[model samples]
Target chain A: MKLRLRGVRKSFGSKVVLDGIDLDVGEGAVVCLIGSSGSGKSTLLRCINLLEPLDDGVIELDGLDIAEPGLPPDPIRRRIGMVFQSFNLFPHLSVLDNVALAPRKVLGVPTAVARVEALELLARFGLADKAGDFPDRCSGGQQQRVAIARALAMQPELLLLDEITSALDPELVGEVLDVVRDLRQSGMTMILATHEMAFAREISDRVCFLDAGRILESGPPQQLFGAPQHDRTKAFLLRVIDAGRLER
Target chain B: MQQEPTRRQRWERRQRRRSIAVAALSSTTALVAVVLAVPRLPGYRKVRAAFFDGEIFVDTFGPLARAFLYDLQIFAWCAPAILMSGMAIALARTARSPALFPLRVAATVYTDGVRGVPVVLWIYLIGFGVPGLLQSRTWSNPVLWGSTALIVAYSAYVAEVFRAGIESVHESQRAAARSLGLSNTQTLRHVVLPQAVRRVIPPLMNDLVSLQKDVALVSFLGPVEALRRAQSFKSSLANFTPYVGAALLFLCVSVPLTRLTDHLLQRERRRMSATAIR
Candidate 1:
């Protein structure tokens, strides 16, 4: 397994955001977390990246317990790159510099070397022409792609995507999903929190249904999406189907 | 095809011109009234001879202008120190580590203590008290101690301005930087400070304007700067025109700074409104 979470628990004040989240991701596996809004999907991704301190339990990466006290999170975060739903690219930097920043600053790469790598990544994402343009100049879809490229520049072992498509317009969604599809084909391990049921069913190797901060069900995407055993999962999928989000 | 103005548009244009005419007439009348009334007051000639003596202004302008260079010299050194120490203090105050609690407290106390005391009193205390306590000739240089006083007092104000700018940055920016494995210092240096500093440039320019003017206050320590030179002429020559000359010299620098601050503020506002559309 590349990543493991055993009994991960997190709370904000009196509200429990992630209650006993236990999961595993094998090498190059793509796991999709499907849930309604406020089902702890985002918080789970944040905790996994160590953005938020967990209230309880352990998260292991490559068999090493990273949840131990006094463990500096920077190294762990470098290994686990995350793309946020809001596409938080640094607005002050150009798309190229946004991608190059972590490599140059955190990884100690030379400026020219980082720029070369960043330009290559931008070209791969169809953003080579936008290398000099700031994030505000790019469309939402382009910004999100640049954000993904930025996360990938660190060459992370595992990538956590927190509802990466949730903020995108319908017409722009496919481009971003295409990027995810390419990453999967390139054998990058990923955990995605997504609202796009069709994309999750198409791309996910394994699907987990979360409700009220717990994993309600988990299995192959077909088994879980087509034949949900739990009532909550079935009800959630039914609402999604009724909303025309999932093509039944 | 350019269309002619509509009736309502022409009427509004005429109204605007009339309002501008009225404004000009009223302001001119007020100015003429003040100008005509002031000279008619009893003993106006004596007051004018003492304060507006053209001969005294011509005689002292050269010396006072040269002395103004001392103020500029003090400002030149103090400005950089103020910026660096102010930023350090702001960072110290914002640090969240349990271990840095004392540092945070000290920063708070330093800002509060320095800001609470009047800048003039600080000049007196640091300039005179420090040298008196040390009893060293090197330390007794009024220019050195006076410059230190300005730096100490002004840095406190500048630090508060910096802290406000830093706090204005959204927490999500910090979160995004941290998620990329940037350490706290790296996030601050790369992500936070750049945005914060850009946002606060207008306000910082305002502070620099104030600092430029206040540099003359160091004349209290008896460095023969512009204000001191003006004071000496006032006492020895029994005339105040050198003070007026000094005021004009100070305004020469400060007015430009004020105009630059306004230009930056307008540009910043325009940038904000443009981005807000996104």
Candidate 2:
């Protein structure tokens, strides 16, 4: 699905989080949104997934506006999957059961079929054996992989991953990134809000830098990262490199 | 290389053990002195007459035990009624839909109004009031009316406990559940409530333990539950031994429940510490 947002705006009281935002992602494209904290990267993603109501503007899925106030989010949300920075897996559920939950409950798939699909997803994610373990028992990286599997179980047309590996130890981040890499290879449409500039540059077809609740600039990653036009983008890239989140 | 305790450390350990033993001996001696001197006080005879008689203690046991069986039956119906109604009321109170406004208002009113009154008043008002309105001789049974009163009053308190549990679940779980296309109710049933119930087990058990004791208050509405039977024994024999007998029976129920709650709390704690965010 081609996801598009136009003149989108949101605010909490006096503070505006997403100020007249506009963006577009083609089908099967990987768009990485990079910004400093509090620059509305996560908020923009949340608005697209309908987790937050839009204040003003249109969020269109394939040229059809789905952001109407009366439109129920449940059906719209089924087409959009999201992962949080903290990998909020259900603690009370077994990994397998967590993976199976959405399909069985929302989609009305029978338990046996859902579990079979969930186990396959678990096996692919190298979590087949840990399927019976609760989320707390798994490592941060493993838990994130399970989270991805859970979202994929819904077979959403678009996926939003908000700093999925940000909470993991440095050594554990690669496992989660590897799963993202595999999804990218499978032609999955994704929007990622990330601090990992190098990973963003490597995987994203287009990179968007957001600042002060607006997209500062967006273009091919190589041009944006290597020879940025915007002064703000340049300053941001310098800090990202100094922090060693980009290649020297 | 590891070193064993030095001479000073060994002496300190020995001194600590010695002090503990001495403290125990002193406290025991003091307690015994107080116990022995009690008989010399003027009130001692009355105390002995009321509580220390073996014959009255023995005489109170059988009737109180039978009445306690009646309390057990009351508990069987009341506990489940409180749990089910409490959870439903709690869910209604927490619902955000504008369409459910009236229900939300009613649930809030019910919880606040019922909880504010003493349970005893509920026994009087509901126990006597409902039957007075209906004026049905068959429905006027005190046991039935009393148990209903207890359920109504306690369910309000338990509803708040249940609501707290439901709210304690992290917002992230709801976000995740929503992203999965689960409806609000589905999210609560499948994700939030089960975890919330687990977290609330300690507090919920505390309510249950107190509720078991409250079962005795049914006697005030005029049924022959254990406390009523024990009070009758006090009137007839002029002794308080039957009260102790009733207390022992209550301990029999409350102690096992308390231990079970402790066990649940420990397991939850251990699991929580494992995943505790640094």
Candidate 3:
């Protein structure tokens, strides 16, 4: 396993967001978390990234306790990249600069070398023509692709994608998901929090249903989507189907 | 193939021309009324002789103009100092490290304390009070002390502006940078400050415009700058025209800066509206 989370808990004053969460992501596996808005999927991803302090429990990356007291998150963060739902590419930077920033600044790579690698990554994502364009000039799908390319530039052991396509238009959704599918084919370890039940069913190696800050049911995508054992999981899938989000 | 103008388009063009003609006519009439009526007032001649004497203006203009360069010099030096200190204070205020808590508190106190005091009083206290207490002739130079006071006083206001700019950056940008493994300082330097500083250019220019005029406040400490020169001319020649000359000099500098700030503000607004569409 590349990542192990056991009994992870997080709370904001009186409100608990992630309650005693436990999960494991093996090397080159894709785990998709599907649930309603307040189900703690995004929060769990953030906790894994060490962006939010875990109120309780252990997060072990390669058997090293990452959530221990005062371990500087910067180095750990470099090893695990995250792409937010909003596609938070730095607005002031050009598409090329956005992808090149971390390699040049954090990794201490020379600017010329970083630019070459960034261009290669951008070209891989079919964004070669957008190297000089600002984030505001790019379409939503293009921006999300650049965001994924930016995260990939770090060469992380694991990537956390929090609702990456949720903010995209329905017509633009496939392009962004195509990039994810390609990443999966390249054997990148990824954890995705998504509202797209159909895409989760299609692309995920494992699908976990989250409800009220806990994973209620988790299994292979076929079993979890086809024969969910829990009533809440079944109800959630029914609602998704009713909303025309998931195909029968 | 050519097309004739639409009937509504022709009517709209005529309306626009008539509106322009009305505007021109109304403004000219107002200007003519003011010009024809002002001189007939009972005290017009006395007021003009006292405040707008052509001879006094011509005589004192050179000296006052020369004195105005000192204001520009003070502005040139103080502007950079204010910007640097303002950024420092703003950074201190925004720092998230627990170790920097005291520094943040100190920055807050300094901003509040300095902003509470009037600039003129700060100048008097620093320029005269400190010099008197030190009892050193070298330290008693009001120009140096007065400029210091201006920089100190103005930095507090500028720091708030900078802090506002810094805080205006969305939290997501910082998260994105931090997730890329950049340290907090690196994220701030590389990502946050660049966007923050760009957003604040127009407001910073406004502050600089205000500072350009407030540079004259240093004359209170007896620096013999433009306002002081105008004062001397007023006392000696017993005419206020030299003061008008000094005011004209101030207007010459400030109006252009004010216009530039407005232009930048408009351009930024346009850019924001254009980009926000996506």
Candidate 4:
């Protein structure tokens, strides 16, 4: 579960989103990426999951380079699950089918077994009764939870969450975050892009401050938030402080 | 016990009653005028005798009904082929592979080339030409050839409908599925196509409605469907009662189908709005 990105670079036509990024995510550790908007936090997670093609880099999951050309992304992707900010649950599928589809279709698990596993997962996520409902029938928080359950259904080694709670209402954010906390307690490896400063400081093992597609600083949460070495980190933390997000 | 209404309520009720009375009186007056005026009009009796002859209609009904079965048969046989071929053409047009470039071009050429020419012309050319080429072969029926022409021509239009449905799925749907280890094909099958087809059902049903009626054009190749039966009676009886009967039969099918399509469209709209409420 050791995820390494060495000299990872990504761009969109003229804009460079991830500029020579380098990082390491240890097994069973939670790495929180904190930054302002357009800071490449989401893009980095996408690159790591092989959802976006990297211009240059070596992304190694347990020392196997996954970013190499001709290395099929699907096999690598099955081991690494990603939950998007938008929830991206298939609108046509029922909540249970959304969770069970990948396991049944890609993993070659039988439908009955997959449905049983899916129901168990839904019950664990407190959406057991809503298994038959479509994604649109659920609240944003519930849908986000289902999206996480869908990614987790594959039993992936590494989970990448891109601003998973930013779309939820203030009151709804806590329920989704609670699932993330439970995942952390269970020692599932994760890297998440988040604007929830308090949540990040509470749950993260290491915090990486990405500014303009580069990690300005990486350290323990207390050091990065309480006593930041980089000036940009201080300025960003000051904004968070003004916004009343950071706790003493 | 009945209570006396308030003055304003009484006035409103009176106005409503008066309006309903006026509407009924006017409609009855118009009907009387039309009935009185028709017999006085020149050539009315002869026209009615020719077009609405009961005996001719009774004579034509059985054959026309049997002939319509051919139309239904063609639709049943060709509709599935049309759907499959149309979907395949749509997928080919949308495919991004360099290896499929030739196929994409060919599909593009077909939809564009076939759509511009009139469908009847396709029926004429393929029906007569193919058999002429294959004179030695046993398969030389113009009706079969016409059915083939209908499938080829209509499939282009249907493919465009299918393409629109496929593209209507949001880009995020693809991203989410692919990120979950599903390949592009799996993503399309499991995620995109299902939603797309759901959204496009109303329009696709509309196309099928048109397709059902277009089955008549096969009569040009002398398949003896309802329309051709009408034409045959036109020549045989020297009257138009059979044509009117045929027209009524088509109305029997298309009107119900049109109403069903309308109901489906409304249901789709309601479902969309309900989902949007969340």
Candidate 5:
């Protein structure tokens, strides 16, 4: 499904986090949103899923205006799955249960059917063995993979990855990125809010550079990363490269 | 590197020390107090005989046994009612609505006030004051009044317990449920409450144990159950033997429940630790 955001604005009290932002996510395309901390990258992704209410904006998913007043957002949200930074797996539930929860509870699927689907998704993420275990029993990478699997279990047409690797240990980050890379190869459309520029550049069909709640520049990854059109994008890229080198 | 002591080993050492200290202190104190109080024992016996005796034991114990049976009957009947109402109220309040403010206030007042007041007073108020106002002479069954008071008081406390349990679940869990398209009520019933209730099992068991012991407080109005039987037996024999016997009966009933509570708590702790390790 195509996602279009026009003139989206959101603020918490007096702090304007997202200011008159516009972007479009084409069908089956992986779009990476890059920005510094508190630049509203996460907030914009949250707005797309309607997790955060937009103060003013038109969020259209497949021609349906999700942000239209008095319209129910549930149908829009069901098609848009979100993976949080914390890999928000339900600690009390088993891996299988976490993945199966949305399907069984929301879609009214039978337990057996949900389990079968959950196991298939887990198998894809190589977490089938961990299905009976609680989320706390899994590594950060495994948990994030399960989170991805959980989103996939909803059969979501659009997936939102909100800095999924940000909370992982350095060694664990690659495993989670690999899962997303696999999802890309499988043709699952995704919007990724990330600091992993290399992975973003590698996997993203389009890259949008956001700064201070506005899109600085957006285009194909090669054009945006290798031959930037904005000086701000170049400065941001230099800072990220320096930070990445320091981490290494 | 040396391995740390297992939890069981640590618990065992702590238990040993506590039991030894309790035993030594209680034995010494009991011996000294008994020696000093022996001279006054005869005076106490004389006073006790005046107010209580064998016939009183017969009069109270017999009827108390009957009343206890009645109390149990009432508990069985009202347990489902209390649980259903308490759960419904708790869910309604947590899910948030215009009614939440008043419901929460009422719940807070009911639990805190009723729990703080002596159950006997509540029994008196419900049985004597309210019924008297209604001009219902048949409301004199202390057993019914006592059970009603217990249910009302305990339900409030349990409802709060359930509310806390529901709230203890992380907000993320609710968000995940909502993202899946489950309505607020469905999220509560399917996602939030199940996990919350599981976390609260040990505390719920503790509450049940407290409820069992509190059943004895209902003995104030008349000999309704075991307490009355023991009191009557003491009066008949003009000795403390029956009271001692009744105390043993209470211990018999409550001891297993206390042990069950401990067992459940230990199990929960283990489950938590296992989860934490992951």
Candidate 6:
């Protein structure tokens, strides 16, 4: 499914978070959104999933009007699954149950069928052994992978990953990225808001640099990373690369 | 590492054993003293007359049996009524509806106001005052009036307990349930309430225990329950032994329940801790 956002504007009281934002992800394309903190990258991703109500905008998902205020949004939301930064898996539920919940409750799948599908997804994410375990018992990377598997259990057409690896430890980040890389190889349409520049360049077909609640530049990985046209993009790339080195 | 036991450590261990032994000896001695004293106490003659003399005890057994049957009947009828009414009021208030605000306020006021006063006052009001004010002598049936009073008072307290239980669930659980496409009611029934009820089991069991004790208070209305029977035996036999007998009867019913509640609460705490570790 193709997701297109147009003239999106969201504000919290007086502070403008998303100001006249616009972006799009073509069918089966991996679009990476990169920006520093407080740049509204996460808010933009939340708008796509309708987790945050948009103040003003049109978000079209697979030709369906999700941004229309009165429209029933569950049908659209069901087709678009989201993975949050915190890996918001239900702590009270087992790994298999967390993945099975949406399918059984929302999609009305039978319990046995949902469990089978959930186990298969967990196996794919290398979490089959942890199926009976709760999220808190798992490592950060394992939890994030289970979260991704949970989203996939909904059989969504488009996956919205909002800094999924940002909350992981340095050593744990690679395992979660591997899952995303596997998803990329499987031709899943994903819009990833992330700080992992190299991963974005490695996996994303296009990279969109956002600054101050707007897209400053967007293009193929080679042009954006190697020969960026915008000065803001260059500055951001330099700062990020410098910060990355300092962390190491 | 061969180390001599410190004097304080050895003394502490000895003290612990001494206290346990003292407690056991004192309890047994107290039990024997009570048994010996019972025959010489002021009411022993009358207690013997009631139990062995077969005068008041046999004559009152019929009424006592009838009262016991009536008590069971009242519990059967009133428990569900109180539980349903209390649960409905609690769930409705927590439903977050504007219309239920008045009901919630009324329920709160009722619980607080009624519980603040002695239950004896409520019994008198329901049993005597209401009938006098309504000018209906038929409302003089002590059984009906007394049960009414019990239900009203117990319902208030139970509603508060239920409300606290419902609120004990974390807000995130509700959000998660909603995100799963369950409606508000479905979320409550499937997700929120089950967890909340589990959390409140200990308190709810305590309420049940207190409620059972409160049943004895209904004897004041004069239908001759265990307490009333004992009271009458005391007056006729002129002694306190019947009170002791009634107390023993109450302990027989309540002690096992208290232990069961404690056991269940302990198990629940262990389960919660294990889940939290996960």
Which residue pairs show backbone clashes in model 5?
A: A136-B278, B53-B235, B53-B236, B54-B235, B54-B236, B57-B232, B61-B229, B64-B223, B64-B224, B68-B224
Interface RMSD of 2: 1.7
Q: What are the per-candidate TM-scores when only chain A is compared? A: 0.99, 0.99, 0.99, 0.98, 0.97, 0.96
Please give, for residues A1-248, the per-residue lDDT of candidate 5 as tens digits: 88888999999999999999998888889999998899999999888888788899898888988998767767777898999999888776789988998888788899999999999999988888999988877899999999999988988999999999999999999989999989889899999999988888889999998988999899998888888888888888888888773121
Greater TM-score among 4 and 6 belongs to 4
Name the better of 3 and 6 by TM-score: 3
* Residue ranges of candidate 4 with Cα displaced over 4 Å: B1-50, B261-278
- Clashing pairs counted in every model: 0, 0, 0, 0, 10, 1
Report the error of model 4 at residue B159, Å: 0.9
TM-score of chain B of each: 0.88, 0.85, 0.89, 0.82, 0.67, 0.72
lDDT of 5 by residue, B216-236 (tens): 767776635766666665566
Point out the higher-scoring one by lDDT: 2 or 6.
Answer: 2
Structure candidate 2, residue pairs in collision? none
In model 4, the number of clashes is 0
Better of 1 and 6 by TM-score: 1
lDDT of 4 by residue, B2-50 (tens): 8899999999999999999999999999999999999999999999999
lDDT of 4: 0.90
* Tens digit per residue, CA lDDT, model 2, B114-169: 98899999999988899899998888898888999999999999999999999999
- Candidate 3, B196: how far from true, in Å? 1.5
lDDT of 4 by residue, A1-248 (tens): 79888999999999998988999999999999999999999999988887788999898999999999878889889999999999999987889999999999899999999999999999998999999888877999999999999999999999999999999999999999999999999999999999999999999999999999999899999899888998999999999889887765
Best by DockQ: 3
lDDT by residue (A188-208, candidate 3, tens digit) is: 999999999889989999999
**DockQ of all candidate complexes:** 0.49, 0.63, 0.64, 0.51, 0.56, 0.23
Candidate 5 - CAPRI tier? medium
Q: Which ten residues in a row have the lowest lDDT in candidate 2 chain B?
A: B269-278
lDDT of 6 by residue, B12-55 (tens): 99999999999999999999999898999898877576445445
